[model samples]
Target: MKPTIIPFLTTRKLNPENQETPIHFLPQTITLKEYFFIRNHFEYPTQTQEAYFLPIVGEVIRPIIFKLEDIMRMPSKHLMLPLECSGNNRAFFHPKVYGEQWEDGAISQGLWKGVPLKDLLALIGLKRTALEVVFEAYDYGKRMDLEGDFHFARSLPIQKALHPDTLIAYELNGKPIPFKHGYPLRLIVPQWYAMASIKWVKRIVVIDHLFKGPFQEIDYNYYPYKDSDKGKTPVAQINVSSIIQQPQSYSILDNGKHVVEGIAWTGTGVIIEVEVSTDGGESWHKAILGQEQSHLYSWTFWKYDWKVSSKGEYLIMSRARDSFGNIQPFKAKWNRKGYGYNAVYTVKVKVE
Candidate 1:
């Protein structure tokens, strides 16, 4: 039985399996310890910068290797970005699929500092016709259901891999990353979900076409919109999502005023608004949006107040509309693989 960290486990490997578990927290002002749910394809190997070696390999003119000191000596770039699981909140829909059983705990934000992927590629002298670059890591070994070693790994398309925002992150939240969080070297594909940000990286290979390992071809890749044309629907990017965070449920009200607040974000743009419903979804009211953040990918906060009339059980829900005018779905579409579930967030409380 695989052990899990706290608040990170949505369901067990047993019947209650849910892989789309959401990471519940605002992207700004993060404490390293509280970053919601960590998904590692492999165990965190122990190796300091001096001991480990990072090599660029395959179809390249000059294969380069960097020691820890070499990487730290370079000019580092920092980016504060938010990432969400494509399958976040998928269990809310029908045909429950396999994944972390995430309730939107599949996200987090942090100050990521590292050399950009493109810069590193250029430093190594990438070939002109390199169609795609594959990141081969130290952690990939075997498959449990399969016979061989269960190695953990994933890959990205050359275009996405070389984006300026992509980072070979060495530090998270201004501190050296913790072991559970990819420690020595990891890829941070800003704005993409955590799955794409691999840990314990060791090798990078340049190939003529997209890499098709079990991860890129089988895992992480899911068919969206159930029973649809799997061919037509490529592995879609992170869909927009929002969640409420304030007014901890089950508090006393004694016929007084109250304030409600929450956070929201989109994979594509900033959150435009957060709507609140107090009458069990009978009606909706606009909540006062909180401090606007300049980081377009970071989550935004919102708030609303309830003038308590009577005390009883209250069912509350929050909906988010993104800058692109894509509103949160009341309930998300279901898939057997459980990908791209971005539904409205709901909560309940008892008032005195």
Candidate 2:
């Protein structure tokens, strides 16, 4: 159960066509407390501290039930990484898709402090055969299915679980997490988008087979294969993506020299080339890539300097080609529910 005194957090809603979508940044520039973007799956129930239980069971030598306070009593580590929703840029797709139409701001980088999962697993004892780690959230009272009420949970592969980067975060930015963004505790998965990071986290289950809970089965997970493709399989990993930060969508710019900047990251490999095109997709110019970052899963800043001549409305687009030649297309791999959108980012602007 969630603790009492859950505070109300503020967030800005986005209008798809006008802006680039709010990236859910934890606005550090202003405000007494950091902001949080709540992903409301169901109604919020009054959560108490006692009912907030974390069951560490399945494929374990000894099962242990952990309390929210117990985990907090342990050591805490702090680190920063960028996290974005997998369906963040989905609304930009011409036909439009389901899920929240997020702006680039939905992606934010922040510092988090929490006890490492590996440490907790050691205290509880781990079985050698354990291959996956499952996290269950408290807000499972209401759901998107007809099976009545069930708990909301998600799982991570054992390999990624033990990795140093994965965190059981309690604090966002410099303060404690607000109720809206999974107060008490939440899972943070770097490199991958927000979906990998489970909110309102409560339980951890170690298992051998893939843990197919409601969120896993009915939502979040997607098939890279199109509807027309037969015998297609649903994959769980996130795809590569990049987005322009400044001059979102269409900003009026006077015909002059300007520098364009953005951030890019890949789930599989490194981003080798980020090309920018001012005139549709005909010609391309290479952007100077920044230095390699330390955290393999975090995004890196990229920029390109360009000069504009004459006056009229112009459309600018950016396409990222990773080291593997996986180029960002104008249209993403479409789906009934938008999951991975690696389409070429196009922004229209008037040049006076």
Candidate 3:
């Protein structure tokens, strides 16, 4: 087993590997490459930088192919982005959902270095008819839910594809992304769920209509109703959520003043505030939001100095509110696939 594989909580060990980060003790800033969470839908494909190339075809003025060395020589940009799997907290659903069954640790953040996708799109020049940009990955396999083998492909709106922040990342934390992650080239879609950031990208196709790949239409979509198909929407943005990292659930602590620390993040807006509740949602107190540790597309660090004078069992909870007036709900919207479970995070601890 690889050294990187030892630390994560393994969800799937076979054809397509999936691992969750140990978020309980993660660093306050960037999540190291070794400790980053891994979410894969298909088995690894053999790749060599020398033999790699990206072909931009469909709905373009002229089809072009970009070699690895040539693309690497172009001007690059760096960004710190947080990627949370659509199924990050699937295991927490009331009625167990059928999926990876991931816990809170399925999200991770990294400083990505790459070329902004808009630059490359400008080189090829998009046609006015282009509506969606489809990203094709190298990995392919048959899934139990699907009938035949299918490559893990997804599409983004033309506007989002041409966004200045979207990147075709080649490096993570100043080093080449590991094989477990997208090594040669990976799409880093900011603020969106990690599903939009397709890994192992080899082909880019722009179409005039919606691209109905299984990963997009069937898998990563949101089904609001219990059984009916009402209000089915695509899973895109990350929900407003916060995680408690310092004093873990069911931990025994000294009857004294303790610091409660955690992280909160959102997709479309900045995290304006985070409320920490020690009495199990009875009342909430504002935490000190770490502005220095925040970025446009990264999670924000929050801390609260909680004093415990009497010794007893205590329940702690944290919820976040975004700049767009989106607050964390008391209960998350239930879905069949269990995509975005962003309810208030609560933990029970014993004070001795």
Off by over 4 Å in 1: 1-28, 34-36, 46-51, 224-236, 247-255, 280-282, 311-313, 350-352
Count of backbone collisions within predicted model 1: 28
Off by over 4 Å in 2: 1-36, 51-53, 67-70, 73-76, 223-235, 269-272, 290-292, 321-326
The estimated TM-scores of all candidates read: 0.83, 0.81, 0.95
Tell me the tens digit of each residue's lDDT in model 1 across 1-352. Answer: 9896454444424421223233443334453445445555454455666335788877677788877667888888887776566656655657677655566566666778888888778877777778877776666555655677745556666788788888888988888876666668878886666667877777778888766777666666556655664743334356667676655555544556776666777766667888899877789999787766676666777778888778787777888887778888887765566777777777777677
Indicate the residue-level lDDT of 173 in model 3: 89
Instruction: Write model 2 residue lDDT over 6-43, tens digit each, in one string.
Output: 33332434221112223322223222223334455555
Give the Å shift of residue 158 in candidate 2.
2.2
In angstroms, what RMSD does candidate 1 have relative to the true structure? Answer: 5.1
lDDT (0-100) at residue 223 of candidate 1?
65
lDDT of 3 by residue, 173-259 (tens): 889887778878899999899999988997999999999988888888889767887788999989989999989988999998999
Between candidates 1 and 3, name the one with more favorable lDDT: 3
Each candidate: what lDDT?
0.68, 0.69, 0.88
